[model samples]
Target: MFAENKLTEDFGDIRNFLLSEREKTLSEAEWRFRMRGYGYNLKRVDTGYEVARMTTQQVIGTLDL
Candidate 1:
């Protein structure tokens, strides 16, 4: 995330770099909300993303039978 091509020492101190990352990086909630537009309701756990598609009413109704 701190690669030279992305953020070099010329940018300034580490604190400023981290602040910039915070501004640029999306939170987990933001990611989930964005993914939903493409038909995915995912979540981040531990170190990876997982879809909780079963929670949708369509899925639940389909599985009810």
Candidate 2:
């Protein structure tokens, strides 16, 4: 019975983690859209993605920076 309870708790933790990660990803995507409006080229890469901002000059000076 204790094992079953532990398993349920573990699953709940996982669900929470997934929900938070999804919210974070959505936020990043929204930010990317806003950046694009300002002549910024943004691409979404899903593998261990980290949110960052590039200076306008940096973006203009490089193809991939």
Global lDDT scores for all candidate models: 0.39, 0.38
- Model 2, range 1-65, lDDT digits (tens) per residue? 01222433243443343344445555756745644443344454454332232443332211122
Query: How much is 8 displaced in model 2, in angstroms?
Result: 54
Model 1 residue runs over 4 Å out of place are 1-25, 52-65
Clashing pairs in 1: none
- On TM-score, the candidate that comes out on top is 1
For candidate 2, list the clashing residue pairs, or say none.
none
Q: For candidate 1, lDDT tens digit of each residue in 1-65?
A: 13223633332433343334436547856645644553444444564544434236232111110
Model 1 is weakest, by summed lDDT over 10 consecutive residues, at 56-65
Q: Write down the worst ten-residue block by lDDT for model 2.
A: 56-65
